[model samples]
Target: MTAADAASLVPAAAAGRPGTEFRHGLVVGKFYPPHAGHHALIAAAAARCAVVTVVVAPARRESIPLELRLDWLREAHGVTPWVRFVGVYDDHPVDYDDPAVWDLHCAVFRAALGGARVDAVFSSEAYGDELARRFDAVAVCVDPERRTVPVSGTAVRADPAGHWTHLHAAVRAWFVRRVVVVGAESTGTTTMAAALAARLGTVWVPEYGRELTARKLARLRLDRPDATVFDVTWDRDDFVEVVREQQAAEDRAARSSGPLLVCDTDARATAVWEERYLGSASAEVRAAARRPALYLLTDHVGVPFDDDGLRDGRHLRAWMTVRFRAELAGSGVPVVELTGPHERRLAEAVAACEDLLAVGWGLADPLLPVEG
Candidate 1:
């Protein structure tokens, strides 16, 4: 925890500056979940150094994987030509109190840089002093009291929703759990989805297909002044577009949303709509039925269907409800049927989501779908 002379750790003279010049700098951390605080330290280092190498070190038992941490770092600084990001691992203690730990980290740090001379080490912790001493470099501490960023990875991980603003979009995506609300018309799925999201203090994704349909209907009405609700038609291409846009919107929301993302209707719901409108669904639509999601299936209790040019009457609604139940029954994903009044329905949906989250919820490391 001992720091080098603060006077000796003055700003480096680079290009146009006139203090000390750091040809190469180093910033190393577990970056378990990179927060704004980490970014501030890197910025401080990058300001005085010609080049800064960030080494991401994750312990074997860490919940967040090493590769994900590397991804976040790369995403945060990929465009910065002078900032190089790397990952290192060793069987050494993670504690900085032990001299062996410092030695092990120094070796790993040197290896990550391929023996490049590090003139400075930047960090917010006192350990930066020892780390810099190992490299014969100056220790530059940025926001040692956490006043500037006022957040940490540990705090973010402990309560993602509470400190969600501190997390990067890429890191936020790692914790977002997708909750899809599906049902026949007039079942209050949309209301429940939005309310649930509000209750959970997260984001809610509106039904993409509904918006697309409304737009198409408006255009149709303009084309033919006599266009009626029955005039609306959706071909395979239209449904395909809906599916694509729905998934895309969900993916985008996942990147920046809090711990939970409530969906009014997901890709799977779009697929069901396709099957309801068309004679059969496409392979892509069918595939969506198999994707992992926490589904809230709304029960049809003959709630009066308010026609918005999309309603197909009670018979069709009842038929679609049966189809939705049947599809959900064999989909192998977790499903909870939501019945009763609006408050009761939302309560059940919230309870179901909490239950799902308790059991590890969606796929582990959902942000890294390709790697998984």
Candidate 2:
């Protein structure tokens, strides 16, 4: 790896010309959960080469899916058109000194590239020289000392909360702790969700079912001119739409939330609402339900039901609370029932969220070299 072989860093906007030193560049990594450091290396490669090919090779035993890693890399580098990303499963044991192990790993990389010529190999590892020699290419090492980004896959896997700022929005969504507040109508669900989000300095997802109910009532009044909330009718399709929109909103919010995300309601709660109006929960609604990290069920025991105009379940609040408790119990997810004044309920909700965060993301260790 001579000085001439190492390409100087350049801006991403000024890269991707055919007359550069290398025509084709290659980068390979596990990218278990791509952090800022990984992005910087890929950007550096894209800066000097006309076309860069990134190979994401993770072991089959790894926790994160190969397709998801590819998706994250592609999305992060979508601005650079010259960069291409591919993925392949590599379960070979890690051994830098053995030639047979090298051959096994390079074979997987070549298969992913489909015989494309690699004139330059960009990496931050000590094995860059050997990898470049195998491909008969120059080694362009960037940030070999981890001084720029100051983060690694191992550090992130062990403690995501400590390195939260180094992770991309998409990757953060994978580790975000979701706490959903669910209960009967007007049972302080919205208020508690907003309060929790504010307390944690994060974002909260509003219930889509409430929005849809208001929309339905407004549409009915346009025809009858005096229609009330009771005039609004709900069908199987309405509940399905509610579940779809609710999950979409939750996913969008998760990307921008802090380590913890607060939700007014979730798809599982939509199933309960479906049963309330439609006589039974549909298979579509049930199938769309996903388990969150924790559920804070606001009991209707002490909370007063406030109907602003879109709610018609004042008398059914007690029944809805019972149904919600039963549903959450059957799902096998952790749930905490909140029963008391607003202050007490919020305190209990916060404590439950803290406990959920304490239990870190239990990601399995990646394949590594053994000490002699």
Candidate 3:
């Protein structure tokens, strides 16, 4: 086959058996990276199965590392809400370069699902056929039309240049639900976020960053721009006052239900804006900026300026990206940058936020380290 043909080959979800009544089904995959094809296969498998249990390869010794591959499977399946990530481990290290252990990989799968009344097995791999035989259940291969769909992770990593975008989306939602929309003069970050929260049935956090920035501006006597005062002691009094009301709202939202939280600007963004406009940074102000899931950096789009002093044109997007990354790096929180026209950028942000949320929430509480 030509290189293009080779590269075009993508893992397709195997067609699952049709259902009239509920059957106990288990879907297993290395899920190197969950993609749309896997999604199709999963939906089919779950429909026939009353309770769908997703079995993922826990050992990432092959490629893509261990943790990330597991996360991909979790997020990909988490998007469904009904699906879940259960462990299937190969705890004993095997020489990946040796072919002897490839067939012995089912011990973890066996242990994880031991004693369960599994009616059938679902997978897109030929090895899945062997797994079905071993488990004494019908092997439901995902290749539809009785066509041989040849695709595997080896093919993907074969070329270091291969794109994994298709694979990443397949199971991204399980980890965190990301909403990275912008707050402009009018498109309503608040209103759009509220609407999205209502639609997705999640909680909404307004751009608390805006209120924080406004509060910081009020505290700084910009006329003395040359002053050397640069710690939270001098700059944080205004921030404390601003956050008093803001914290109450966050406290309420934190206590409320919903897997996703719609945050208005975070305290981190507020700190960056203060430092930029005032030419200084303090320890206390820096602490608050690290709190938001991400920053939207509202541009002069959507709604026109109605005399709000917060409007900063020209360098808004570029500067926000820099300032946000700089502030967030200390906390090791990754930020996704969303940019475009008024409504488009806002929507992009929301989508990104939902993706992160999918990844974040997918982890079992015990596995997830609590964030301060």
lDDT of 3 by residue, 1-372 (tens): 121221122111122333323355667765555555566678777666555566665453443344565566565566543444455555444433333554465566655555455567887765666667767777887874324433444443342113233344323222223333443334355656676577657677666656555555556646554433232232446654444555556556643525455666555555655565566655676655434455554443334445455545334545655655565557555555444564675566667666655443222111211233
The TM-score, computed over Cα atoms with residue i paired to residue i, of candidate 3 is 0.44
* Count of backbone clashes, every candidate in sequence: 2, 0, 42
lDDT values for all models: 0.75, 0.87, 0.51
| Structural RMSD, model 1 | 6.9
lDDT at 102, model 1: 70
Off by over 4 Å in 3: 1-22, 60-84, 91-103, 144-372
**How do the residues 1-372 of candidate 1 rate in per-residue lDDT, one tens digit apiece?**
001221123233234343536877889887877888988888787778776778886666667777888788778876655666777664465565667657776887677776667788898987778888888999888999999889976676656666778878988777777788899987888888889999988888888888877787788989897776577888988887887788888879888677778878766677778877887888877665435457889988846777766666557777878888887787778899988888888889889877766654222221211221
Best-to-worst order by TM-score is 2, 1, 3
Query: Model 1, residue 358: displacement in angstroms?
Result: 6.4
lDDT of 2 at 171: 93
Better candidate by lDDT, 1 or 3: 1
Worst 10 residues of 3 by lDDT: 6-15
